[model samples]
Target: MTLLDIKDLSVTFNGTPPSPPVRAVDSVNLRLEAGETLAVVGESGSGKTVTALSLLGLNPPEPVCTTTGSLRLDGTDLRTLGDKEWRSVRGRRVAMVFQDPGTALNPLLTIGTQIADAVRAHERLTREQARQRTIEALEQARMPEPESRLRQYPHELSGGMRQRAAIALAIAARPKLLIADEPTTALDVAVQAEIMAMLRSLCVDLGMGLILITHDLGVVAEQADRVAVMYAGRVVESGPAAHVLKRPRMPYTQALLAATPRLDAAARTRLVSIEGQPPRLRDRAPGCSFAPRCPVAVDDCTAGVPPLAVFDGDHAAACLFADAPVELPAARPASAAASEPGPAPTTDGPSPLVEFDAVDLRYPVRSGALRRVTGHVHAVQGVSLRVEAGRTLALVGESGSGKTSLTKLLLRLERPSGGTVRYDGIDVTRPGPADLRRLQREVQVVFQNPYASLDPRLTVRRILAQPLRVHGLDSDEDVLVGLLRDVGLDSFALDRYPSAFSGGQRQRIAIARALALRPRLIVCDEAVSALDVSIQAQVLNLLADLQAEHGMAYLFITHDLAVVRSVAHRIAVMRHGRILEEGTAEDIYASPAHEYTRELLDRAPGRRDAPVAPRFSAAGDTGLSPTTTPASQHTNKERSPLWRR
Candidate 1:
């Protein structure tokens, strides 16, 4: 049976005078069967979230926002439901999981209280009954310790634990339909695998339909039964996951697949970046929204919007020439072919750019109202590593694995409890005032979220100029323009604030600021993890080009193994605050020595060797069979004792 059906749905936000109303979601159509999984994919502002919000009647009021057309759930028209009626349907029949659990979950309330409250809202359960239901929900979500996590607040839990708590809350009322928006965007690969597995299990056991909204194609390939590619507020393509991913009819879908980095691709391979940006909502043209960026677009494509043409089975695409033969770029070399040995590092070469000799970092653990010290949280253990000049060293690990702590030692943000940290042969662990100033100028960092890093109040010129002015360097217009040009931006961007630019553009601004002081070392801390695949390719290419031109070394820290394979020359696997394996990327990828390293590789989604289970059968069966080996069974083997602290 159809769990949810939407046809000719349009959402428009009203604008003030002199500005046209913005149609965020345009005449969209979608359907989901009970226990089926549908994935909605697009860039940041492509109407994915707006369409999901429309289902729950979460958009602005009638005057500020206008919604029209059919939205039905289980044969009932949802568009006609009033405020009180909608409230009853929200958590009982449907629930939504947001991208950032940090924002979705309440910070002041305990995990148990929040889940219990949600349970009590939809059912006439007593306090004890609600508490038991909350515990059951957490266990069903595969949380480590459902009973012990009741009193912990959101801030006390790790990223993965917090997300699991959010999932628990969403499922507390046993909603039949679940909508998850970028559920694992910020999680590590291992944790991401666990979450996806748990979600798949829930769909099978509870017979719930799932709508997954995300930009990560790998996760879609592994988990989604059907795919809907949205662009500029329209469904450009939709079909079975296998057919759409393997034989995409739309240019946009093909471009996205081509741009995604694969684990088998050769290192330093340039990714194909989509040329222009998506059309703005207010300035949307009459024809296809993607016509401006489509490679094979012609005059006819701009004449009128193309209808969704159905061809092979249920596969369909909205394009004038969906059957036309197009030439795709050649595939990158395989790992075996690209593993040819390069010049090996030797002691005779110039001194290492950065070195950590038996380093250790520990934070004092405190408790009670008086905040008395109990023990210590060993964030980093004795670890020795080296990054040669003009090279990229990837530090790979899961959350709470001490990856960030090592970077803190290198940046001198925290002094090590043991051993020495040397930068250009200078002892950086405890540098004097003069040496600290020099270190600051020579070492720069690009953070994970550009929106949080770049000041929203400042324009592009001011953001870039602030760094140069601090170092007493030239902050002239010519220099600023040159910086923008270096990162593939024009001078027109100088007057615009950070909010005006996309995620990729803001990251470019951050990189330009990092280059203002002519730093020799750049620390990219999960920089590209949050961006779309197409934008991620563009940023990675830009970073590679800049490094080649300036001969700068990079400490690229990330949990994305596929991305690490494409960029890093050397790999270091850290877990439980210790390095388990370190070697050349080729050697490590070919034959990993440690069990943890192999587990990380095996859990990475979208690998050719890994086979995905079929989500549905030929008889139109929507129910999926649970995996024989539950993901929770591996918890004890994968998790370390340190995580308990």
Candidate 2:
């Protein structure tokens, strides 16, 4: 049965007097059925979320764009419903899980109270009844100790735990439809897998219809029954999840897939980046939104918008020339997929520049008035690895793994309880004040959330100059501007604050700050996960170039296996504060030794493609699913398969 349907949707944002209003959403149409998932895949500001918001009449009428559409839920037109009715239908029938749980949840209230509000708003329930259901909701989301979690504030929970609580709140009313917008963006890979599994199992058992909005195509392959590609507020391509993915008909869709880093590809091949940025809702172009960067665009593409047309077997693409074929490079060479190259350095180098010699870190779990350490939380245990100068060492694992803890040890942010962190000949764990200061200068860090790392009140100039001042180095405003420019910012941005910049721009600023100290070692913690495909490409390339020039070592920590495949020289798989396995990127990819590492490889995005071949995995990836189902049904045969490389 059709749970929700949106038809003839259009949204226009008000602009300054000179230009026409920006069209954020065009005549879009979509449908959601019970017990199925519709994956809305797009880059930032492509109108995917805007469309979803419009469907629910959730957009702010003032300041923001006004929407015109027929939004129906179970044959009742939502647009015609009055405010009071909408208030009832919104939470009772359809609920939303926003992107950032931290912001979505209020800090002042306990999680229990927040969920109680949601339940009470829709259903006529007693305070006690709502509280009991709230605890149950938390449990349903797989939260540990649900009863205690309800009393805890949002700030008290970790990223993953907070998100799970949010999901539980959304489902508290037992809504038939759930809109999860980038639900797993801030989570670690392992946590993300758990959440995905929870979502999948919940939907199946409850027959909840799901609208999953995200950038991760891997999520789509695993969870979605159908998929829709959105760009410039328009549906560019769509079909059964497998079909659209396997054989994307739209040029935009094809570009997106090619550009995305695949974990199964060659270790050193440059990312297939689609040049240029996505269009903004405030000032979009007149023609095809993707025309500026499309490789096979023609004059007709710019003349007017093309209608979505059928390609094959339920798949449809908006490109006018969906069937007009030209040769596109295989996604990855088949050979590149099956094997990883050895650690043959680009140049003859001294033994790895940085090595962790049996590193172990532990923190005391305190309790009661005595404040005694009851037991220790083993954050990093007996981890050893080497990072060669000019080479990138990617530490990949799920949450609860000691990836961040290990980086902290390397940077001396945390003192190791056992073993040592060696940089050249020195034991960094016992760094003196002078040595620590030098380490900060020599080993810079780019934090995961640019928001928290940067001072929002400080302008770009001030932010960039703090490190310079710390090291007793003085420079004029011009020098700050130069640093900003070096990281791809313009002089105009120098006066702006952190809040004014996008995530990608903030990251660039962070990188510029790291470079200001002229660091020899750079630590990247989930640096590119928040960015869209195009911006990720630019940052990855810039890092590679800078590494070649500076001969610095990079300690990259992330859950993204796709990026690890492309950028890492050596790979260390961590699980619960222990290094499960450490080896060259090629060996880890082609022949992972540990079961945890194998499971990670399976959960990675964009690994399966057309022309994929079966390969023997004698190393035993016991943690991963052995069944090799076709990842995307619409994938073309031209792309090289990483499995057979």
Candidate 3:
């Protein structure tokens, strides 16, 4: 049963004279069956979400947007549906799981109340009946302790859990089609897999059609049956997931494929990034939307729009050269990599950078008006480890595993309960305020969400320049412009507010600001997890080059093991606030001694020819290779793992 269909769909948003009406959804066509999954993959500003919003007639009419073309669901024309009729179809037949679950949920509402309300929205079920359905909904989403979580607010759950709750709500009415927009973007690899598995199972068991909107190819490869590769406002390619991925026809599709980290193959070279930003919706290109950055784009490509034509094996590509042989594009120019690096990624080192000695961190738990001392919860147990300089030390664990707490201790954000952190023979754990401040300058941080980390009211120039201002260095406007230019952001962008920039662009600005201090340490918290593959590689390569030049140390915190292998020189596997394994990246990747470490390595993204984690430390007896050791002596990789936790 073809469940939903859209043909010649065109949507436009009204704006000022200079700003052309946004051709957000330009002459698009789509079809979905009763039980199938279609992945709409693209970077930011690709009009993927715009098309999704159009499906439910949920797009706001403000600025007086216009929609033309046919939109039908189950042979019913949704465009002619009145407000009441449209609302009836929204949750009862078609549902949506929006991106950013944190913001999507209502803070004041309990999980049960929210789900119950949705169930009650369409049907008149008794309180007891509604409650039962809510519990079952949570269970269907695979959220643990569904009953207990019903009373919990959105804030009480972790990012992964919150998204699951949202899924539960979306599925409460048992819709025939589920539209998930970046649903798993906030989760770690293991958690992402868990979510994907649940969604796939739900589709099979319930005969539900799924429309997944995301930029991660791995996610699409795992869960999608059919893939729609979107560029600007058009679908560049559409076919079976395997066929589209294995033999992409369009130049943009090919680049996207080459750039994505493969789960089965070893990465042979630096990923090829399509240089330059995506085209604006208001400024539709005269020819191909991707021509500016496409390596294979010929002169004819610029003449007019290319129609998506049949290629092979149920695949269609808009590119005229879709039948051409597979060709890998040349590497983007060098200065381009540095000058245009979007986000400042915490670089990986090929050497050991940080060492811990008998480390223990505990926060005093107090209660009562008298503030009587309560039993202390050990955040980090007695732990000792070494982090190679210019290399990455990936810390993998769940939220409560005390990952951030341990990082705080290392950064001197909190004094350890008992232990020492040594950096190149300097004990920074108990450093004076002045030294600590200087240390902070060298150890910059790139947080998970760019919006929360960046001041919303501030312009790009002000944010990037503020770092230099605080350090009492390079205050000249030209210096700031040069810095912006170095990070692939144009000077014109400096004048715009952070709200105007996309997630990836804001992240780039964040990287540029971090570099303003020229620090030696960079602590990344889920850095590239939210970015597109092409851009993730661009940022990753920039970090690699910067590390080669500056010899900086990275304390990378992520749940994604794929990134660990790609960037880490050494890896310290953590579980339940304890380090499970510590070894050179090679040992961790090739011959993981600990079962936990092996489990994490197995769940990483690319499986074939995957770039094994960088080996910053040599492992003995195991015979695993190590990252290069510095010229200095006395530093041993075989040293005891006991330092400080």
How many clashing residue pairs appear in each of the predictions shown? 0, 18, 42
Which runs of model 3 end up more than 4 angstroms from their true locations? 263-269, 329-379, 411-431, 475-488, 605-645
Clashing pairs in 1: none
lDDT of 2 by residue, 1-645 (tens): 888788888888766677568787888888888888999988766777778787567876845566787888888887787888888888778889987677789999999999999999888899899999999888877787899887789876766678888899899998888899878776766667777778777778888889999877777787899999998789998889887776666766765666567765778656545545566555566678887766566688888878878877678888867776332333433233212233445565657678888888998977779998899988888888888777788988776577877888887788889887887656786767777677777888988766678888898888887788878775566667656644445667778898766555687788778867767888999877766665565567556645654566789988888878778878888888887788888899998888888877776655555212122122132211233211221122311121111
lDDT of each: 0.80, 0.74, 0.72
Ranking by lDDT: 1, 2, 3
Off by over 4 Å in 1: 330-347, 449-462, 473-518, 609-645
The most accurate candidate by lDDT is: 1
Worst 10 residues of 2 by lDDT: 636-645
Q: Compose the digit string of candidate 1's lDDT tens values, residues 70-95.
A: 99988889899999999999988989
Error of 2 at 587 (Å): 2.0
lDDT of 3 by residue, 1-645 (tens): 898788988888877787678877788888888778999988777778888888888877756788889988879988898888888998888899987677678999999999999999989999999999999999877788899998889977766788889999999999888899988766766667777788888778888889999877767776788899888888888988877876777767766665664433332234455456677677667998888766556689899999988866588889877876345543322343332223343566333456777788887767689898887877788778777665567787755567777877767678887888776556786677777777868778877666667898888878877777887876576667755644456677878898877666677778777767877778887777667777776666656656654566678888766556556666787766688888776677678788766665566544533322211112332111133221111122221111000
In candidate 1 the C-alpha lDDT for residue 507 amounts to 77
